[model samples]
Target: MADPKGFMRHARREWPRRPVGERVKDWDEVYVPGGVLPFVEQQAERCMDCGVPFCHEACPLGNLVPEWNDLVSRADWHAAAERLHATNNFPEFTGRLCPAPCEAGCVLAINQPAVTIKNVEAAVADRVWADGLAPPRPPERLSGKSVGVVGSGPAGLAAAQQLTRAGHTVVVYERDDRPGGLLRYGIPAFKMEKAQLERRLAQLRAEGTRFRTSTAVGRDIGAARLRARHDAVVLAVGATAWRELPVPGRALAGVVQAMEYLPPANRVCEGDLDVSPLSAAGKHVVIVGGGDTGADCLGTAVREGAASVTQVDIRVLPPAERDEAVDPWPVYPTVHRVSPAHEEAGELRFAQDPDADARLFAASALRFSGDGAGRVRAVHLGGVDARRRPVPGAERTLRADLVLLALGFEGPEVAAGGAVAELGVAVTRDGTVARDEEYATDVPGVYAAGDAGRGQSLVVWAIAEGRAVAAAVDRHLMGATSLPSPVTASTRPLRA
Candidate 1:
């Protein structure tokens, strides 16, 4: 360890977030610069090197947490980075965006605050990048097999890199103009700058992974033809079909889906768009969801100069502190979290809960009042009781110049009369694509991964599924494989 008594001497110190007012003026990451390394090393010393590390179990990718922590504690940055990348293909992405379930499973968290594992992981990745340690590792021998990856999100990219390094020719197809799917457009630059993604893409390109951007596989190329060309096909198309609010006045011009609003804002960061179509500037914005995506919208609105921003959630507000009975130690707690966006200009409203789990609950968007030009002016809410029956004298109207439906996604969109339908691949009752252990659908040689296989989830899960599916494909192609499958489709948190 760097210091025997480092943990005793120093408290857990994390990267400081930028001042809300200062960060709102630009699209840079929210954290304060250059103050993370020294503290990260100190935090690494907090690891007790448990007899059986549960942090590894907590992570779907089975990351070498304690080994890297020890390496980092010893100031062996390069070794720490290597140990980190041994399992995870994209530590940079996960370090920035993942919720850090690994920290939740830390042994030290039984009493004290968990070691800052996520922050240290990010520090190691940043150090590796600075040292130019990450280089292309192209395979020496060609397997004479080819693989096709549909989607350019985390899952697709991870699988593509692994498959390519295994001596198989890989081609990744992305429907968007750019290669990084949600990473390129959906995520705002303030969370993770696009430059990090571009650098990884450069490395992947150098490693012989070809990218075909602006190509929709099922639409542009026949699925049958694609299957014929490649020995195996991995579908990593993320769940893009957004969940929507079907309340009255949803058809209003000023109302739009959160995904539709987020992309243009990200595009603006790329200097590709002069103005986003769903700009939140100078409007009274109301975001109707309190998830991470909704938080992202809130932050974007504040930066875009929205006159006011209000985020509403139907569920009862989470406890400000962890509830031991409900959420024990070494598990992620469902406690209130103050995100950078929450620190910015926004009002978070917790809706009154309905006693019963009925269809509408105590929720009802009564109507949408609009202006003369058919633009939304305000929203009418009718409070209901346990059975969704309207409560007496609970009608309220809130001024809403722009309403964003930040209500998450459903599943991947199925194009009408496309290969998905033609092949008769099954869909679950919830509309997610059905797959077996190998991530293969009913049709042979066609596999699914990430959100396409599972529903909406964390980026860490996506990367894990990608790595697993790649191993399955490699095994199918070569009769056997050496690639690692760190996670399974059934793997989830103990509570989840």
Candidate 2:
């Protein structure tokens, strides 16, 4: 236990965010610089260290939450980072992007606010980086076996790193010019700066994890050739087939997929583009879908100087507070919480309409209206009843010069699954690659991980899948593995 009375002594508080007016003007991270460290110890002390420690169970990586909380409270930054890395390969990524289901399962959440585990995690990661503790650990001897990973996202990165350290030669293949798959493109810069990602990549490179960028295993080179060059292959390709709104005016010029809109903006941040090709400047932007992707689009639109930003959610607003009856302790709850982007958007719109949340709950899109030149002009939407049926007389039109469909991905595409066929693996009916509990495909010497096998999932889960697959591959080659397998491929959320 951190402190017997620490939960009551200190209230749960998170890192401070920069002023909305100041932050929206730039693409830097939304939080204030060096803000989390001062109070990180205080927040870490709030952990009760329950007998069961549900937070660890909730996390896919099985992070040492209680141990690190105690370490942070005791002012041991190096030990905290060591414990965090014991399970997770990239705490920095999860700290910024993950929804923190571990916090939802916190023992304190039963009666009080959850501990600031995510913030503490970020602080510990940053502390280690600042302390120059991220030196590369090259393998003592070569294992002779080699692996070719087909993605450079979190999962692929994790597998590559683990295999490299386990004395195997690992090469990560990425189709994009840069190594990081979605992390380098899909996410907006305001959420997480690329410097954090670059530094980690530097560590991986120092550790001898080779990255082959702009190389498509299935298209540029044959997958069979790659298999022959390497002992095994691990598919960590993410679920990137963006879903569409199949309605009238589907081909409007201004209406684009969320991937199309976000990647260009990120490219501009990467210095590849002077201006984003899909700039939202001076346009009325409407983002459909209330998930993190929609929030990302909203934030990017706001930074790009959109005139107005509106978000549409198919489901109604979640409860203001956790409902113990429906979602008990240790299960992630449905609660209305304002993300950093939402806060900035709310501030942007507060002057015009104090009550406007810029979100239309339970709203279903009917179709998009296009101008004579085939550019999106407006979006027609209607409210839905409890059963998701259209409500009578609830139709409304919103001005939308730029419409970004943030509806989540539809798993991997067959074209993207080109490597799967070359390796002779089976895909599930739900559009994901089929693998058994060991992440092993029907074909020998080939396996799958991340969204390719698990469908759309969190970054933490992808890393976990990567680690598990690395273990499976290591054992397959060395006849035994010393790596820790945190979760099996069949693991599911406590509550759907």
Candidate 3:
């Protein structure tokens, strides 16, 4: 356990981010490099190591939060990394990307600020690499069984790693030219550098996990062929079918999905492209969604020198603090968050909002107007009440040379001749692949996990599903297995 009085002695201090002025000029991550290391030990000390640690339950991965916090506080980096890795395959990704509901479930957060769990986790992840503590651990023996995993995202990668380490020959298939599904393309460089992903991929390769890039299972290789070649097949295909905004002028030029915009921008960073064709340079951008994806677009546009960027959310503004009565301790709450991108947007005053941020809450886009060139020129918006009914006389318009619809995703892309369609897998009414609690689909010797099975969710959840599905596969193959199953297909977050 950490210091008993540490919470009282120290207030929560977050990892310092680079100044907005400098960060917006380039795509480097917003955090000050090595900033967390200086104070992370003290932050870790704030963990109460509660009698009933709810942080574990709050996290979909069921990461051993208190144990790692205690290890980090004791300056035991190796032990902390091991503890973190026991459940989460890629703490580096989660440390940077996860929203950390674990912090909201912290006992200290009942009245005081929660410990900087994310910061400590990230610091330990960095140390694992810097200290050479994460050398490839290839299995000593081979199981002689082979498995094919579709998609190379967090879930696919996690399942591949666990199965490979379990002595099974694992091959991960990726549709993109490169391995990482969203990690390499959908996510921007500023949020998490590609270098971090590359290092992990290198380790996986050394650990006997094979990757077949640019191979779409249903198209490049038939699903039947893949299943015939492997003893078992795991589908970690992610939810990527983006939801559309069926408003006027949606077909206009410069009106695109968030996936379309983000990937090109990331390609630019990967040196595959000199510049993003959809770059927001000098354009007045209107991103119609206030989720993380919208903020990502806002930041990317700001860095691209957009004339202005406004993020519109149909939902009303969340409270600054959790309403304890409605959202009690140990349950994730709805609260306002100021991401680094929001800070940059606020500092630049790129959008006109009374709160000095880029967000425009409780507002719905009514329509989009296009110019003579068929390019979007402006977006018409209207205020909506709690019931999403339009408020009278509350309509307005904003110039929008470019509009990104970050309206989230519906489910996996089960297009005609896609993996799901070709495999004849059962799909739920929710559009996700139908699977049992063990993550097995109706088809024999085939299983589904991650976003494909769980629907659109967090990175932590994807990794958890990956680990859980791997255990199920291993057990089915060897009659019994030793892999950890942190979650079930039916498991949901402990949030209100």
Candidate 4:
């Protein structure tokens, strides 16, 4: 242990966010730059370093949490970065985007507040880059094998980088004009700057991973042609078939899908556009979902100067703290989470809720009313009970000039002539590509990973899948692999 009584000596101090008033005016990340470095060592010292270390198991990547915490506490950043990179491909992405289920499973969380695992992780990742500890590891010998990765999201990128480092010629194909997939377009700059992504991309390029952008595998190039060109093909296409809210006025002019709204705003930040065509400036926005994507929309809308913003969640409000009876120790619990966007919305008093939060819990949208020009004007809502049954006399209405459906995704999008269909991969009833425990598809020499095989999930899970699938592919080609396989296809989270 870094300090035997460290847990007793230190109190959890989370990373501080910039002032709400100041942060909302720009697209920079909410956290104050270099703010955690001073207190991060103390926070790292708080790791109890338990015998079993549930935090390690809770992570999808099986990250060495306690070990790295000790390394960071001792200020051995080089050793800490080495340990951090042992299992995870992109700590910067997960440190910023992951919800950190590992923290929820922290041994200290069983009693007192959890250690600042996420904050320490973010600090270590940033330090690695600042100190130039991370460098490309180009393979010393060529394996004479080639692999084609379809997608440029977290999973595809991770797989390509690992395969490249393992001496295989790897080419990643992306439908977008640029790489990074959702990291480049779906996520806003305020959450994680695109520069972080570019840095990693540069490292991958230096390590011999080639990228082919604006090339949809199933559309631009035939699946058979791709397979003929490469010895193996790995599908990392993420879940893009968004869920729909088929309510009244679904086709109204002002109503749009969350994916439709977020990308344009990101493009504006990329300087491709002066302003988002669907800008929420001076408009009342209603987001119909309560997931991370919805929170993303809430923040983007707030930054765009929305007149008012309200998020509608179908489930009831979660408890302030974890309910041990429902979710025991080491299991991810359901609790109220206040993201930076929520804080900004609360500070601005943009919500009409009694608690002044931007969310409306246990509410369902019944219909939408439109203006004479086919634009949405209002949303009709009704309260629901535990069983999702409507409550009597709880009907209400809210004015809404813009409606964003953040209702999540179904599965991988298998368009009429997409790669999935051309490759003859079978899709499961859950809408994901059918795969064995080894991530092998029905077709020989073809594999599936990430959301394409596991359904929509967190970024941590996507990276884990990417790494695991690479190992599987390597083993198939070389008859053995020294690469680490963190998780399998059947692996499930310790959730309630």
Model 4 residue 158 lDDT score: 93
Worst 10 residues of 1 by lDDT: 350-359
User: What value of lDDT does candidate 2 attain over all alpha carbons?
Assistant: 0.88
Pick the winner on lDDT between candidates 1 and 4: 4
Poorest stretch of ten by lDDT in candidate 3: 352-361
**Model 1: per-residue Cα lDDT over 1-496, one tens digit each:** 4565666776878888888668989999998865587578778988877888989988999999989999998889889989999999999899999989998888877777788989998899899898998988989988999999988999999999999999999999887899999999988999999988999999999999999887776678777778888988888888888987877788888888889899999999999999887898888887777688988888888889887676665555567776889888667888767777877653322112221111122445667888889999987777766455777897867678888887888887765655355445777887778998878887788888999889898899999999999999999999999999988776777473
Candidate 2 residues lying further than 4 Å off, grouped into runs, are: 350-355
Provide the TM-score for each candidate, comma-separated: 0.93, 0.98, 0.99, 0.99
* Candidate of highest lDDT: 4
TM-score of candidate 2 to 2 decimals: 0.98
Q: What C-alpha lDDT do the candidate models reach, one value each? A: 0.83, 0.88, 0.92, 0.93
Ranked by TM-score, the better of candidates 1 and 4 is: 4
Off by over 4 Å in 3: 352-355
**How would you encode candidate 3's per-residue C-alpha lDDT over 304-418 as one tens digit per residue?**
9999899999988889999888798889898889888889998889985545888888899999999898989999999998689999998989899999999999889998888
Candidate 4, 1-496: lDDT as tens digits: 8998998999899888999999999999999998999989889999988999999889999999999999999999999999999999999999999999999999999899998888899999999999999999999998999999999999999999999999999999998989998899999999999999999999999999999999987689998899999999999989989999988889889999999999999999999999999999999999999999999999999999999999999889999988889988889888899999999998899875645679999999999999899999999999998689999998889899999999999889877787788788999999999999999999999999999999999999999999999999999999999999999999999876
Model 1 misplaced regions, further than 4 Å: 1-6, 346-366, 382-395, 417-419, 422-424
